[model samples]
Target: MQFSIYSKPSRKKAWLLSALAIALLGSCGKAPVQNQKPATEVKKAAEKPAPAQAEAQTGKVVVYQLFTRLFGNSNNTNQPWGTIEQNGVGKFNDINEAALKGIKELGASYVWYTGILHHAVIRDYSAYGISHDDPDVVKGRAGSPYAVKDYYSVNPDLAVDPAKRLEEFQALINRTHAQGLKVIIDIVPNHVARHYQSLHKPEGIEDFGANDDTSVEYKRDNNFYYVVGQPFQVPKPQNGYQPLGGEAHPLSDGKFEETPAKWTGNGSRLAQPDFNDWYETVKVNYGVKPDGSYDFDSLPADYATKSVQQHAAFWQGKDVPNSWLKFRDITFYWLDKGVDGFRFDMAEMVPVEFWSFLNSSIKTKNPNAFLLAEVYNPALYRDYIRLGKMDYLYDKVEMYDSLKLVMQGTGSTDAIASVQQGMADIEHHMLHFLENHDEQRIAAPEFAGDANKAKPAMVVSALISSSPTMLYFGQEVGESGTLDSGFGDPSRTTIFDYAGVPAHQNWLNDGKFDGGKLTEEQKQLREFYVKLMTLSATEAVFNGAYQELHTVNKTTQGYTDKTYAFTRFNDTTKVIVASNFASTATSFALTLPADLLQQWQLSGGDVELKDMLSERKASLKVTGDTASVQIDLAPLESVVLKF
Candidate 1:
């Protein structure tokens, strides 16, 4: 909380100005009508087949994510703690209650909590990144929820009773189910803690492959950041003995290293020092670890052939406690807790086998559970696992690559074409987004840095890609996702911001949505997020199959910018999701297949129509071949047509 970090910008004045401005842009696009039956209204609708018929006819599916724990324990509040100014503002504190309530209201089919269990940590590395000492964050909270200390227990601070956390978690699940939302907790099965009671080994403990019994202290080796460590390794540890270290069961088919020396340690977290003392554990050969620890730790493995064993997440790989599950349990508990699914954290570092296994497991609980990948380039999926599993992954490289080629004023259409070609060539298992947790927010992604144009660009990719779509909070309304890269700032994701309303400020006051720190911009952006999330939860266009209509060129790059327009339609419903990312208004058109036009013009079952966010009816004129309409969108805006 220093005056030095960011020259604290004046928020109050801007707050007053934007509140007034929403009215000018008060385009309350009519939300899709609710065929959704609350528990009370279900009886009458149960006999009526509206919802069921539509579902059966189209085979629709939707994903609703909570983005935090308390969706693990979030609460639903009635008011803001104080006035919008000088008071309890846009923060979510009580996650449990709010999550239960938000699910049904938002209509999320699946609810996901990012981190909810007893998140792990290194003596100090977990909280301090590579530093050996703890960093001064809010109350010295050392690690992100990604770091796991204990797998079985939930975070004590999150619940009223530190001891009965799991019980309370179950209660949260029941409450969520009452609201018709499914829970999905986080699961980290690859690595364990540095000095947990289960895996501590003293300095003199006999080496058993990777110091299986040593207190996890691999700071000297990079491969052990989250791998396991030697107990005496930490300057301060609760136990006199070192913690046991863990590693992936070498699942690769390559030549074995025969010793831990070749495997320095895990460097992905970049949170710890390197280790050269791993004496226990064999890295699989099916895939090579990023650092070449053993092999196949990254590739898809044949679980049936290999004997399975590994710890949970390791904050630091070297000299770290040998108990990381890698990418299994922590996220799994979210699913266990009734969260719908997760936007996988650093998916690339995790082996492809884990995802395949978990995705299948989730089906038993809730087949509709949605899993979106944060992989660098979904196009990389061209290297499909002979038996890999996952619903969708983000295509990071291609998004930036295409943005540079197209919007930056230098690339040819072929440049953009190849990117789409990769999309076309790959299987239909992907989720595309302009931004998510790790990168900078859309309003200020290094490429465009144009707050006004970010939303349109992000939406362009989200709507057109064959993968299921998503809107990271704060993408719309031009809010940035900039993080304090110098220090450990709890993740806000490179995801787009969709919240930009007054309700979030009010919700923050009610004391459930606060995440400790937020600015006025955060509050405004949360409103847009709520609307965007609501749209995703409620619309049919986004949930079903989609195809790009036209506009290979002519869309601008500023406000009123029009990019590719697409349509998500079924026999009974036809929704046009048209977008323009440039500042000047542009017109785009689409022609429906004959089957669609015949059904529409004849049956006129195009009974209902609405825009996703604005909640307004769409304007249109239908002739013989197609229904013609000129959509007017502000730069960085989209129109979701629902029928």
Candidate 2:
């Protein structure tokens, strides 16, 4: 369905005036300008407040994913394959009270400290008795965070004192909590580094695969699935690729010793995995045999709907996989250290039942533990949520993909309505994000190439439902991810190398933790995100019922496919949201269906609608079976109009 809007230059003046007034009032910390109407006009359409059912639901979750290693690295020397000394890494201490307070002010309830765990790196810490990783197995100068080397310790590169790395991380967690934000760290359940060894495991806890029978290909209790007989062979460098750009290093001989090979992290069973495979890591075994049959007890059918406590009870006295127990202990250990939650890496690669056992165990320890997972398959969404007991799954396949297409001007906003409808039953379980460590930055030439293009999309993503909204570090001010930082391709912020995020550094502004060096456009973009995210976290209407106005307004004049509209409301508060993906200013009549008007118990009259973000005002005219509000939106503009 196509939608078009007519030009309305006059409304721009009113909108500017409203925005200026709101900004002036906001500086004084006063309430926004109220609708000036006669008492008779105000009382004409007043109705009873809706029930507090939506309020009874869980509060909205807003996550700010901060790449721990990059968040505070003030050094702008983004030299390719730069060493820690040359590039300079951010320490846990850099995320001080001021930094955390800045994050808190950005409306983040949880700060996902990505890459905090001890991962395989090229840097030698032999003085601290840490074994050096072979450059052939490591992905970059700074290894991939998913190739975790130790579950019990934090990354040494992020510490002011490498000997006290864990202590520094704990201090960071405390600071995060002090700022009213919870902590979330990566839990790579599917794999560990190729040379996995836990030097800091707790007493009486043997390392993974320590007691495994390596002679067999698969064992029910084995920590890793082995390809017996064949010695592990390092993948041959291809496409002219070399470890550390063919740099001279003692361990860069294209050789890694293993008497018997283990499966690759991505489930490649070959002893000589392709260079494209996850060759740096080995997959963890969770009792699923080579033939894909379960080697352990399976949950009953009714267990899908069971509570976390019930799921935990079901696993009691049951013989589960050894890897399951190992992960459980590791996670529990972190919980004891005050981590509030985990972001499981490639969670779908592991079996669902294992998650059921692991996640339930986590909830038993902390009922409010935020369990978010990276499960890309939409087909497995329900199974993971219901059976696996996942608190949140990435809404990438549908919500993120659709919005991205809209931003690129290659897809219609109608697809967004369809996605919301398809996932209506499990909307809250899906987490929304526009940018992350994995995805291309919105400002990258490969993406929309402009940070401003994401403003409307971010508005919809943050306010669409009760699900969590996530903002990657530097997304607020548009880090283009255009740097060729080595190992990984450009367009995605390099998670594999020691490099500084230039745009993020500008906001860092020499550790001031303020956007001191940001341009006016960048500051405005960040302000838009700040307002949207704060409302998402603090507003009840976000967690309320939703109704799509896109389909209903398809045939309406001045309404086009480039514009999307919807409403989220609860017992008391109601908001109409609209976004223009077009590149030009457009004016459209945003219509609220008759059913919604009836549900809201509003009689035919003129209702004032105020833009929550910009403080712009519009009048909703209700006459008989029709209701619509004239809306003027600039290119990539979005509004949250509360009546």
Residue-level lDDT of model 1, residues 94-171, one tens digit each, is 445553454444334444554555543222222322222111111112234544444445544444544455566556
Per-residue lDDT of candidate 2, residues 1-643 (tens digit): 0000111212322332332110111111112233221112111101221211112224578899988898899999999889888898888999887788778777788889999889999998999989999998998898888899998788899998898887777777767776777888999998889988787777667788899999999987799988899988998777788888878999999899987999988777899998767788988888777766666666666888889999987777676767888888888878777778899987777777888889998998889899999876677789889989999999987899899999999999999999999999999999999999888899999899999999989988888888999999999998899998878778888888899999988889989988899988889888888888878888888989999999989988777898999999999998999999999988888777889999999888898989999988989999987898999889899889997
Model 1, residue 205: C-alpha shift (Å): 20
- Cα displacement (angstroms), candidate 1, residue 186, comes to 2.9
TM, every model: 0.57, 0.91
How does residue 491 of candidate 2 score in lDDT? 81
Stretches of candidate 2 off by over 4 Å are 1-59
Candidate 2: Cα lDDT at 533 = 83
- For candidate 1, the TM-score is 0.57
